[model samples]
Target: MTRPIIGRVAPEQWRSTGATAPGQRTVGEPGTARIAVDLLGGDHAPAVVVDGALRAVQDDPSLHLILVGPAEATDAVFAALEPAQRHRITVVLGDSAVRAVAEGRADAVVSAGDTAVTVVSATRALGCWPGVRRPPLAAVLPTATGHLVLLDVGSTVDPDAETLAVHARLGAAYATAVHDVPEPRVGLLTIGTEPGKGDRLRRAMPRRLAGLPRYIGLVEGHDVVLGEAADVVVTDGFTGNVLLKALEASYSRLGGPESTRAAVLLGVKGVVVVCHGAATGADLAGGIAFAADLHRRAAIAAIVTSLSDNPVLTYNEVSHD
Candidate 1:
C-alpha cells in the first residue's frame, strides 16, 4: 500500500476524448475481441500498463485494445506502436474502462485498479446477476491434482453468509464452465474442516450451501494449493485476498508452479479481469491475455447457463445484507 490509490473516476466526466489509429482492418480484426484497459490503474501505472498493452497487441495478431486514461499516457502507447499498428489501438480518456464493455465498445475490461473502485464501476455500468448484490473475483491456481479456483480474492470484504454462498454457486459454475469439470466439487475454506471450526460467517455457510450437491464439506487453506480436496474453494473476500497475496509471494520466492497473476470478476454481464495493484508488466500482459481468452471461450455465458440449470443453486437464494 505504498502508493495512495488514485481517486475513483467521477461518473459524468468519466468518459473523455479519445483517439483511434489509422490503418486497414487486418484479418480477423473486425471479429477480434477488444479489451478495455484501465491505464491509470496499478501502483506503477501508465508506464507498466502501457508496456502490458504493447506486449498484448504484439503477441496476439487479432487482439485490439481500448485503453482509457490521459492523453499523455495513451500517447506513450501510441508512440511505441507503428502507425499501421495503431489501427489495433483505441484510446478512451476515462478512468472507468469497464464502461467500455457495458457500452458494447469492448468485449472485456482489464484493470489493476483498486478493487472497490472497479467493483463499484462494474456493478453500476453492468448490473449484477439476479440476487447477486456483490460479485467475487475468482483466481484460478495450479495445484497438485490439476487446478483449483479461489474466489473473492479482492472483491466483497466482510461478506455475509449469503454472499459466501453465492460465491460457492459462482465458483462451481466457473469450474464447470471454464474448467470443463462435469461436477465441480466445492469446499468452504476455513482453519479446519471440522464443524464449528470457522468464524461466524463460515460456520453459518454450511446450512445455506447444503442444498448444493457438489458441496464437499469443509476444506483447509492447504486445499487451495493441493487441489485434491476440491475444484472450487470459497471464502470471504478479506481472507481470500490475503491468502492469494501470500500464495503469490510464496510462489515467487520458491519459483514453483506458475499461475496467472489475474482474477476473473464473476457474476458480471461482461468479462472483467483484475490484477494485483503491484503487478509487473508481464503480469498485466498475462491479464490482458486472460481477459481475451475468457471472452473467446464465452466463459461468462457458460457460467450463467450452468448456474441457471442447477436447481440447487437457484433454489438457495440466501438474503443479501
Candidate 2:
C-alpha cells in the first residue's frame, strides 16, 4: 500500500474534511480534560467510541469529553451519562475534531481513524515541530525487562534513512520525557545487527544516529521484545506498523496487549493519539486516558525541550534510500 506523504496542506482545507454531527452538551470544569474525539473514526465507530467515552468518564472523574461526529453518535454519549454526568460532556457535530486542537477548543485530540487521514489532520491542524519533515507515530509497549518505545508506527509509512534518524531522536526524547527514562539508549531496528546487513535505509541509519544521544547501533526484533537492547528503537512505518499489529494480535490471542492501546503522534506541536482501527471500547478508552496523561504532563513541550540541542536530520543520498 502506498503510504500518505506528509504534504503541505492548508489549515482551511484540512478542517474542511467533513463528518456527521448536530452538537450536544457543552461543559468544562477545573481539573477537567477536554479531548476532541472523532466520532466517526475506527471500524465500529460511533458504537465503540460511545462505549469508550462513557468508560473514560467513569474512570476519570475530572475528565471532560468533546464528542465530535454524527448527532446520533453524540446523542448516544449523552444517553449513557446522566444529567449530573452531562456537566462535563460537550458535543461538536463534525469529524473536524482536529480543528478543535488547532483552534484551542480542546487540550488534545484522539482518533481511531485512517492513520493517513488522522496524521494529515493533526499535522495540518497543529503544525509540525521545527526540522521535522515527517511526524512519526511512537508507541510504547511493555517489554520483558522494562518498557520499549517504537517509532514510525504507521505515520510515515515510507520514510528515508534521515527521516528514520530524525525519528530516532524523537523516540528517544519521548522516552526521556514521557517514560521518565534518563539518557535513553537508542537503536535502529532492522533484520540484522551485524554491520553491512539489511536494506539501504538500515545501512545508512547508523551514521546518522551516531550523532544522536545514547545510540547503541543496530537492534533486531527480539530486542524490541526484550528491554535489554535499547530503550528506543527506530524503524520505517511499514515495518513498525506491521510489527506493532502482529505483536498486538499475538498478545491479544494469548490474553491481551499492553494496557496502553494508543500510539502517540510525535514531531507534531500538539497532543494527538492514534488508536488502531481494530481498537475495542477498552482500547479506545485507554487511548483517551493516554491523551489525557500526555496533556497533563505537557509531554510534547517536554520532548521539544529534551531534543532542543540535537542536530536535525539532514537530507542527502539517504533521502533516496
Name the candidate that leads on TM-score: 1
Per-candidate TM equals 0.88, 0.85
Q: What is the C-alpha lDDT of each candidate?
A: 0.81, 0.77
For 258-283, candidate 2 gives per-residue lDDT tens digits of: 64878999988799999999889999
Give the residue spans of candidate 2 off by over 4 A: 1-30, 75-81, 309-321
Residue-level lDDT of model 1, residues 152-214, one tens digit each, is: 898988898888888898899899889998788999999986789988888899988887868
C-alpha RMSD of each candidate structure in angstroms: 5.7, 7.8
TM-score of 2: 0.85
